[model samples]
Target: MKVLYVLLCCVVLCLNVLASSDEEDDKQLVEMERSADLENRKRLHTTNTFIKKHVKQRTVRGKITHFVCQNAVTMEKLTFMFALPEQNFNEDPVIQHAMELELQREMHEGLDLTEVEVADLAYHEKNMNDLGSDRRVMLKPDLALLILDIILNPTNYEHFDFIHTCRMIGLFWSVKDPTSFITNAEVTPDDNTCVIHHGTTVVKSFQYDDDSIVYVDNVTHKVLNPSFVLDLA
Candidate 1:
């Protein structure tokens, strides 16, 4: 019994010593990696030849609207616009990416987000990325991630609304395109009475340095009368 007790005590002390040694080793490794990353960033920033100087940039803007359907019972319309920054046509791809990231950070600051939940839709059930599976992929070949959002209580119209039910679904891929996705949406009220409101929402985004512009336009019309309510979804 005495021998066994001494052996157990030695084993515990050895384990504690090994654990402390491992902790020290991990700390040293992290510090080394952080130092390396900082040095690389400094080198990139100080390199004067990284980005070209004194180049011409072009800014293009346009707007278009179309009526998909117009009838007494239902009406749907679409409109879109874009305002691209003045970027040198032959700018270095890396520098262009840095500029876009800076712009995105500036735009997202102080932005408000609506609460959303994951929606259960039939199309989302199958494994779309499985090459051997029978399910068909719904996105483009270069798309690495996709998200779908659905308003839960879309019919419940309110003035100066504070909250709304929504759903967001995300899909990820092993490989993705190098482009960033940006979108904006707004809802406006017309007048009060037999409330007839016509609002248009525009979604705009910039593609990668090599890709073209992308946008989405949506126009919605709703009439809330004494005995009838027309909602848009």
Candidate 2:
């Protein structure tokens, strides 16, 4: 009977020791987590404060064709006026594709037109998936303040040039060749804001009015810009 009691006491003592060890381990773990969270909070607060200081406040809208002096003296801004129809404003993809076709048509004045079925088949095959546009994306103002801020402020940017820029305006347009764009466009004061009467609705006009040419560190491929102000009203 005394031996049995001794054994029971030993087991209880062992369990108590184990429980205390487990509680200590849990307490350490909780402390470590609290320290990490506090550090993260500090970092996040600092980052938020830093970013708030440099954010730009002003905005300029509309598509821009530009004539900036090589020495960064006088920069000229010009935009064109287009009479876009109501249908073009509502169904955006149709309007976008139509613009590209218009560019091809303008560039290829003498080429024969393809049948609707053939063109549709080619388009569907090449573009299998369509990314639906959010109303916010369509509604985001083509504000030029971000470009202005980058030029004026230089934390992420070390170098910037006020280069001559022009736009052959259309809905879905890319620089034919950025290298060619660098030296190819001639900007006389007279035709800088040109009006090539490609007519409204049918011909679909393009405008280049603004002096906001976006450039990266060394690469010429641009991913984003505050270009093409969409006030198609």
Candidate 3:
């Protein structure tokens, strides 16, 4: 009984010492990594201001995007740019993406959105991104993000004096084409409304040659193009 007791005590002490040593080693590694990260962030700040202003970078693989508003008054339209560094540690190909974003500004009189309406809105937003899955273009949003509304007495349009459903979607787009898959797509206002499939995508230019084909180059299925022409009334 006495030998068994001593052996148990010895084992417990050994385990405690091993655990403490492992914990200290982990702490030291974490501290070193944090110091390195801080230095990298400082370097990034000094090196690029565009990313600092627009993107909230975290770790080497993640970024939090900010919306670039078109008009402060009517922020119905926006654009955004995401800079992805290649060689995260210096071996990957860095790519910068720019795209248009849309948000609706409606004037509903005493109308309350039902559960279905809210679900539909979420579905539409998700569908927008899903439609572009083939291009590996995904919008990674920030955790500490919010959508706030400001009541505006819009005088331009009659019959409405107060604003309720007003939320902004922000993005940025440029022409010096970053991605290889790109072409021009346009949605013109005809007698009827154009149901744009991917209006938020960055386009090269519109084709007057054939409205049926949105964007075409030397070959087929090689264009970052979409259609606003849907068979509707």
Candidate 4:
């Protein structure tokens, strides 16, 4: 009976020692994990600090070109008026083609005459808008006359010159017209004051007018000028 009790006590002592050793091992594993986490956090913070200290800041300079015309431009529908030189007005195919190329180079960018009917002088003009919008405009003989009248040789002299003078009298809708404009959730308008709105309008309408209208940039009205004016006469 004494031998049995002694063997039972030995077994109990061995089990207690094993339990204590297991607890110590668990504590060491937890400390090692905590040390690794602290090292990772320190490395992340150091990388962020290095980026903030060594990163270079850049500033972009924008050019602001103002209009020269001081002749109180009244708001109206966009219109241009000019008379073509008599020589280029005739229905010579070669001359017409040259005139078309000149107009494409000066006024219309990416202008392609997809269909040209020589008999009726009617054609379809596929063009790109300033905002990279694509449009195909069908121009009849009558409408072609109006467009050519303004864009053709502006000097109105005996010899042929590509540069022509034209008068533009109208308010152009820079933004989409109320009828066709789709609602954009991204555009947020400033509701703060009129000053912000006015500034935005001035920036949008810069160089809006053609070069024939505003000849020289006048310093007096440099703050707000919309047209590209020139005195060709």
Query: Which candidate number has the best lDDT?
Result: 2
Clash number for each model: 0, 7, 14, 11
Per-residue C-alpha lDDT of model 4 across residues 1-233, encoded as one tens digit per residue: 99999999999999999999999999999999776444433322322222222221100000000000212211111110011111122345355334334422322222222323211232123211211121111111222332233434444433322111111111111121212211111111232111101112321211123422232222222334333322111
Comparing 1 with 3 on lDDT, the higher-scoring candidate is 3
Name model 1 segments beyond 4 Å from true. 47-49, 52-202, 205-233
lDDT of 3 by residue, 158-212 (tens): 3321111111112111111224222121233432111111235533222222323
**Candidate 2 ranges with C-alpha deviation above 4 Å:** 56-144, 147-233
Compared with the true structure, all predictions reach lDDT values of 0.24, 0.29, 0.28, 0.26
RMSD of each: 22.1, 23.0, 17.6, 26.8
Query: How does model 4 score by TM-score?
Result: 0.25
Give the candidate order by descending TM-score.
Answer: 3, 2, 1, 4
lDDT of 2 at 25: 100
TM-score for predicted model 3 compared with the true structure: 0.30
Per-residue CA lDDT of model 2 for 1-233, tens digit only, reads 99999999999999999999999999999999776444433322322222222222111121222112233221111111111211122345454344434422332232233545223322111111111121112212222333344334535334322222222222112111111111122233542331111222111222232333332112222323434333211
Q: Which residue ranges in model 4 land beyond 4 Å of their true spot?
A: 56-233
Q: Which candidate ranks first by TM-score, i.e. highest?
A: 3
Candidate closer to the true structure by TM-score (higher is better), 2 or 3: 3
Location of the lowest summed lDDT over 10 successive residues in candidate 4:
59-68
- Clash pairs, candidate 2, are 64-209, 64-210, 65-208, 65-209, 65-210, 78-209, 79-209
